[model samples]
Target: MSAAAPTSGPATGLLAVGAYAPPNVVTNAHYAARLDTSDEWIVSRTGIRERRHAAAGETSSALGAHAVRDLLTRHPDALEGVSAVICATSSPDAMFPSTAALIAGEVGLRGAAAFDVSVACSGFLYALAVGHSLIAAGLAGRVLVVGTEVMSGTVDQEDRNTAILFGDGAGAAVLGPVPAGYGFQSFVLGADSSGGPHLYLRGSALRLPAGTEMGPYLTQNGREVFKFAVRTLGDSAEQAMREAGMSTAQIDWLVPHQANRRIIDAACERFGLPLERAVVNLDRYGNTSAASIPLALDEAVKAGRFKDGDQLLLAGFGGGLSWGAAALRWWGGAG
Candidate 1:
């Protein structure tokens, strides 16, 4: 079914993007030395050769702030009339004083409304939709959407299943009103709590099932998650495209969640999109949860891969068993 055309209102556009990754690089050899794995094995399985690790005392806010700072430096006008900051993160600095608040304070946006969205890797897209709606609703003229994750602290180093699959990074984008028919067109979002058991990080305050115990580290059933992701990626993207009145031939790029290479390849094949037209960076950053999409987006934008008026389809799935997709045109006629 096609998405209903949105009511006339301010059209939200992605003005600029930026990202940051810690300097400390953790290669496969580091894991191989401890776990029974090798560079070839890790690459073959996850397509990751190395990933960034936050240094001692670094926090998600710090990384996010850095990314925002980078964006501001490149496009100083991006924050003009900005009134809110929405941060998407699964690994937040604290339960209270949301990471968005911390990042806002770091970037000198003290009076802006600040909050956090915790939906694992799909969070950036969720937060983006919220930012877009806020602009359309006239509540905010512009919003800063940041996705940051410090997964190094969340993963159990001893667990080969997850340790080798995550990294730490942040990406930020400024969303503001663009010309008519020039920005975000439609979004498709969904969730299934039943898949929660397949991927989760137990929190101290969360109630557990009868025999379940709280665990601090991130946990996952890789096989189950892999199965869910491949299907959801293609399904979500297709749904978003349909809603946006776009077809596979009209899409210029597919910026998917940087989870697994195999999942991405399978999803592309199923969606009938060529692998070459997809933006992928998992080989270097691994899976940065909420940070993956924005990080890939920022990199691609900087590389001049996405031209004005390019039709882009973004899709992601993660821990909440949540999946989301957005169909948007690259920076177009409007400012």
Candidate 2:
């Protein structure tokens, strides 16, 4: 079914766009106290300075609530009758209840069809697609698609490789019916699960098999993830652009996962998109897992950079060695 999503202005429709990010910034120097790495090293390799993470007693649900709360406040009318909530993440506060359920509860959205999706860094895009499709199928008039992660809790504190790369944050968008020829234009998603082992967790001890203790840290093949992210991310972006029936010349913004500057630069270079146009915030947020895209989306729109009718391409690549991209036609109208 075709998405009736209008694209001229914010209203009576879907993905009116919203997001939230915490204020805490953890510099590499901050990690220096807990690990053996230096700020210079982190900067040289990751193009990062400091990243935002949640405060003590904060959970993924709480940070996500922060973003959702901000979105509701900014566009309080958007959720007046929203039908569903889709949260995307790998670092859910609990494995059983799903982050969506938690968020719905937090918003007092009782009985809303809330659920979670896990596709690593590609999650936001996946959830975005799901939200769009759900509306297109007439299943819901409006959906709040969110990406939240509190990865600090899963980092292997002793392992300097992965510990320095992740932080916590969340972003969201309100999706509803639109006029036409706007909103999500096209999407491309791909994964190489065989490489899942390259970046994976051993799971919490509480959920482990008998005699299998919970691993105190996350693990990864840093070099492999780095290599795959650069190559696959570029390819996936090209595919998404092609699927959207657009050319590299038309992309107004490239909001990619805030994992590394080098990777972001390489993907832009491959697509011939200027580096200045692609949103790069890793230096401040590290890699907020799924939170990266929405975080970047929010920043771009708030900066007055994203204008009406601008073409925005969102892409992401991360653990599970996943990659995704989507094209959005900006509707330059009132919110």
TM-scores, each model vs. reference: 0.96, 0.90
Best by TM-score: 1
Candidate 1, RMSD to the unseen true structure: 2.0
- Model 2 global lDDT (CA atoms, 0 to 1): 0.78
- What is the per-residue lDDT of model 1 for residues 144-234, given as tens digits with 9 covering 90 to 100? 9999999999999998889999999999999997766778888877888877878888866567434434788887889999999988888
Residue pairs in candidate 1 whose N, alpha carbon or C atoms collide under 3 angstroms: none
Per-prediction tally of clashes: 0, 10
Candidate 1 residue spans exceeding 4 A from truth: 1-8, 209-213, 332-335
Give all candidates' CA lDDT scores: 0.88, 0.78
